[model samples]
Target: MTDPMILSGTSSNLDSLRSQLIAGSEKVQLQIIPQLAELGNQGLEVIQEFLWQRREQTPTPVDGKIYQLLYSCGVPEIKDFLQVNFPQGVVPLKSEQGIDYIPLVELLAISDFQAADRLTIQKMCELAGEEALKRKWLYFTEVENFPVTDLQTMNQLWFVYSEGKFGFSVQREIWLGLGKSFESLWTKINWKKGNTWTRYPNEFTWDLTAPRGHLPLSNQLRGVRVIASLFSHPAWDNKK
Candidate 1:
């Protein structure tokens, strides 16, 4: 049954929500829990895609089970799952497809964007850069199994390694400008998690549908370069 206060006005207190999920009728477990888990899985998939498109290095093999869980849970629930499992660290796994990307679409639907300008598409690649993309795939054991920082720089490094359009190691020199860190982008952009609202500047949030969230545009231009890089690296390409 739905929370009475939820209908009345309490919104949702995660602790209470958890209690209700566990204490509710056993039948609820048979039905509702699965749906909730699906939502969580969906959210994970969204983050996964974000990582892939923005990444500049080799694409890692996708895990099947994680994808399944995300396909079911959606975003908020997935966020909750991450909070429960990792608590302080980030969960960087992909699960499903459409569920996570939808939020970005919803954000864009509210406004009008042109297909030709390519403004939205370019903006997204800028967000992922290269260093951030690299760090996402890097199996870092330090920092308690979490990325310490320099996400943007790591992604840029990936771009250089991949020969992607933006990975200008010496051309644009944006990486040189970041000094030594890329996670600073988090600080540069100013994002935050709120109860129900995400204010821009102070915070920014979007789903997979938005131009900024989409990665194919950038990937299409650079994927070939990355693939070539892979072939050149005999060790990686020849690994058995």
Candidate 2:
């Protein structure tokens, strides 16, 4: 069902794929999106239908997933449809724990990253199990066991809506670029400067002006172990 090269747009196969896109599990939905994109407008029309149902009025996680995939097709109709329908933001949302990522999508889409960063922490905490959920700060052990799907979903929300300017994946890329040096990585992302931590709510840039991989601010004051856990998580390895 993931590959539909032989299936014409009008064929029942496309309908079945559409059904899969709507009702399939997260893994299935992710697989079918690329196949859906290959169908041209027929494919796009179904994508459009899938996304439209999850519009701001209704707001399902599926809308956020499709939103993240919107750039895959540069077709003028798709572009226009997105601009007209989802001016605020877009994506298909799913989570291992049935976590709602629509809030993160809306926050990112509208460029309200201050709130998005807060929600990002909340979402990650939720994924780390009930203790971390209540604590609202993750322990390294919890992070070591984090789900890649949930992390990728969160990273996609940040990456797509921010025009690729942010996300955990972004941070990880910079981390690796600095030879995996935490000090260098922190400095590169403006999280620290000359041994001084970046002051919250004032020094940090909420918009595009910050250094690359800057938003979704992690509490480095808690020290390196948590941020280290995040940068070293399997989630970054599975970002595709």
Candidate 3:
């Protein structure tokens, strides 16, 4: 059953809610997006209604917020709805590992980088298996837990989506260029400014225009230990 507080909106109420969502501040939008997720199918219906109504209009921040909510809602049906509606916008790529991924460009097109990031990691976890738990803890001690092919696949998706501006491969290149100096790599990736490591979500850039390697994925925000695990992973040595 749909949560009453979530989708209690009549046509009139939804119209008012939509207007408020479009005009709301970032904090307001964040607070509301999660509530919309709680509505399940009803929440999706509201977003789909808005998307179709604005089909002829240029995408806006509100659209991004809506898409973010959709991704966070984690509904396979909602993702399918997006795939069907924006077929051309969502490009599919096959990794050398024989894994396939849908680039989050369709989501990014509406300007929702956070959703894209979340979806990217979600897709990676879906493909990689038990390694996800290891990834969550930034624990790559067991080489088998972190497959190079999966890492490559994740990196490829980010590279394709951001037009080569962000990805593990991009970070690898910078790391190699700096002679594998972790300190230099950190500074270059904006993970560190001078001697201080930058904070997550806030200090990190949530947009495509961010510098190369700024979108550190695989939940590396826990601390330097996570980042170290990622950098030291055997995946980089896989020529494939």
Candidate 4:
């Protein structure tokens, strides 16, 4: 792990160090990305502060590499920071159900769809709050339901980031088109084949080139109940 102090230096110094760290081989990036994230909120703050300082220097390759590192870190605080600070970067969207939402596109700028997908799920869990973990699925109730706005926000994020290649709305469209058959829906999303669920995090494609409806990731392989919980959510209902 690079010293936290290194990241706390002047913006130029931090930029130089970030360049050196990221410019190293892929193996180095793998090592450093996790270490940076391991620093937790402090590390995320350092990155955020640096990015803000360097905001004037747009379209730099270094920024791309740094954003990739941030997305790969999968820290919810980083996602929150990006969402709050770069509101314009996140595209506003509305679901067919008339839910207004916004997608976080700052991470998508890194072009790592797999990382974006993972981070999106983490962000959803964050938005869903503690009950989501207690319930073991994002269950919606009449009172303390999963916020439709947040769901739509995440869906839009996935849609815009993947160029309409993935999102809940995308999946919902395919689901309805296929008569809401989970089996066919799984196949359409490349999550199943020949009666076996696709292996998690391995067989899954990590690039934008993955099949349509392939994201806004649901951990259906966790069990059919997980899929049931996801599909049965009121957010999927088309009626406003």
Candidate 5:
């Protein structure tokens, strides 16, 4: 079996380091991203802190995996990072080669999707459409309220979604649509019922099916299809 990796930093200094990273400037030393990446659970906690604090500077831009981490934490830095680094065009989130601004989502959620990286967002919005971006965000909030059962479940949930395409599937697209009309839909629907099996709480209940140790994006598409069906159901759509 492969051994779990441990970070080199001391436990005592961890908190201070994290606080500094969270509250510190955007031009943080490049080393911080890797250190936090290696820090295991400590690193994740720091990432959350950074998202919550919503620092407005250039966030530590690590590889895209870190961007996925930030997204799971309700941060999406894709648009902002693209604008700042490549003012000439849209930067899609792909493999390690793609620009991964985990910080962009952070800026979007905190600023109501008004990105500091205006150029990229403006351009991408044209390509992906304002609604696609809106839907992407909607998925974030909807997933956030999902009953995780526990912190461990929550962690597992993040692992599945961040690593696999299933998490980003069709359910997400539907949720994104829902996000555009969140206040209205959320107000009418029974949030209590949102936790039921059919609503997608089942993904966690079943064994993770990430393909050959990798997340399949198709799974995400299927999930959205499911969500769309539910929303379009006769009962759900007919409600006054």
Candidate 6:
């Protein structure tokens, strides 16, 4: 695993890396891609074949990694595949407060939905000011102060990477579509099931098959005000 993670690429290791990619743990699979890329065309050929194998299934975070790596590899065929299938391009990390959203983008790109969700909360708290960042949550008033550009940028990272399945904007759309009904929105996004709230970690679907707008979860536990403020945010008003 250590070798695959950091080794200089060589022709002899090409087949070995390919085999590791096919059967390796997610950690290995992800780490080995750079090693694979280091092998040049030989490495890229492996990546191309690997990507083709997963073309039918939903794109994973590894798919996002490949999308970025392929651009660096200078392969026309792979780049074309990216242009068609992953047209979201690189998500813009716009932030009025100069917050770094690259980590959020990276997590989303790898399809690490839960990590992204956690980071989403962190970023929102960051937007709310230092006290909120220290407390790790938001007051509804703080939500109103969130910069529209930052929110839209965060939403784009989640929305585009998740095949349009998730994001705060998607949640806002759901909220508006239901005539701004919060209870209905909860049920629709699977945040609640009948009388009971879905338990975190155990009940949330953390993947593409989860209900639409089910992710990038706002701090809904403090009641609907936070999410309500988020849904009502002017971020939705601006045209991208």
Query: What's the lDDT for all of these models?
Result: 0.31, 0.75, 0.60, 0.59, 0.36, 0.78
Best by TM-score: 6
Instruction: Return the TM-score for each candidate structure.
Output: 0.20, 0.64, 0.50, 0.52, 0.25, 0.66
CA deviation > 4 Å runs, candidate 5:
1-9, 55-240
So what's the TM-score on candidate 2?
0.64
Scored against the true structure, residue 155 in model 4 reaches a CA lDDT of: 62
Clashing pairs in 3: none
Q: For candidate 2, write residues 37-83 as lDDT tens digits.
A: 77777877888887787664533334545775674467787778877
TM-score of 4: 0.52
Model 5 / residue 198 / CA error / Å: 52
Candidate order by TM-score, highest to lowest?
6, 2, 4, 3, 5, 1
- Write candidate 3's Cα lDDT for 43-112 as tens digits: 5676666665755564434454565456556678877876677553323333544554544555555546
Displacement of the residue 194 alpha carbon in candidate 4, Å: 0.8
Q: What tens-digit string does per-residue lDDT give for candidate 1 at 1-240?
A: 997876554324333434454455534423333344444433334444433343443332121122223333446755565455433222232212211222222222222122211332333333344553444321112212222122222233222212132222321233235563333322322221232323432233222232221222222222233323322332322221
> Candidate 6: which pairs clash?
61-110
Candidate 4 Cα lDDT to native: 0.59
Between prediction 3 and prediction 6, the one with superior TM-score is 6
- Most lDDT-accurate candidate: 6
